[model samples]
Target: MTGRQVIVRRARAEDIPGLVASSAGLFAEDGGTRDSSVNVDWPREHGARSFAAALDDPARLVLAVEHDGQVVGHLMGSLTGPTAKRPVTSATLVSIHVRPGHRRARAGDRLVEEFLDWARRQGAEHAEVTAYSANTDAVRFYERSGFAAMTVTLRQPL
Candidate 1:
């Protein structure tokens, strides 16, 4: 691994385009594009608006990880809570995506840490994330980041 420096920070409005690019990289992985029932082309106009909205929303966090002034990674997180089963507030790591070349540079860890800090400030008592069960690499990554499997999601192809 190269000793390159990476910066993780809150996403700015202008960062939408870069963030969307990373989002496309994410969707292309793990069949996200194929599995979607809706017709949504990521890194496009709609996605730009969505990222901008996320930046403005107080309840949501969008982070961008930059390497040498270029956005190579992004993460989205939000606070969820007060379900009938769980009364305590929790933070969900909505999604995270890093460019293929930037994995293992502690960028993912930094992203999670920042999100957790945000959740704690929002009075969240627990943290959670969901990953595709079939993606063993993702599962291991989350596990290393201190997440354990809490639910099993099963799907049927009709």
Candidate 2:
């Protein structure tokens, strides 16, 4: 709530539309091709339904960052049991977005901090998030927020 007076809070099912719209712009700003087939709106169309079905499920947590009563950012996370690679309760940040006008104003950092707090409250030992290597700005932001480069995902099309 620095430059824009944002308020971070748990996301409700009704906030899906605004969240999806913000995500679309964020993705495009990061150089993602404007392909509706490979965008947030597509997943939202289906994911929102699933999210609604799991609204009361303890494993899922969705948060929205609102500025001046308008949603300008979102963070979606899920809690998972211990695994061989990550041997402790953990929360993974599935997606986070802040509108372009709101970028570089510490809005993203605030949203992430809030998400981490939520994760810790849910008994997570560690919190994780992923960003495309091509999105260097986001990578830097996460790094500044105390995250390190853990793994890299490479792809080759057949």
Q: Count the backbone clashes (under 3 Å) in each candidate.
A: 0, 0
Top candidate, metric lDDT: 1
Model 1 Cα lDDT, one tens digit per residue, 1-158: 44267788999987778898988778777546446663446456477888888888888999998888899999999887778998988999988998888877888888998998999999999899987777888889889888898889888978
| Model 1 lDDT-worst window of ten | 33-42
lDDT string, candidate 2, 45-93, tens digits: 6656655654567887777878777888877788998889877998888
Overall local distance difference test of candidate 1: 0.84
- Which residue pairs show backbone clashes in model 1? none
RMSD of each: 2.1, 2.9
Model 1, which residues run further than 4 Å from truth?
1-4, 33-40, 43-45, 83-85
Provide the clash count, candidate 1: 0
Residue-level lDDT for 119 in candidate 2: 88
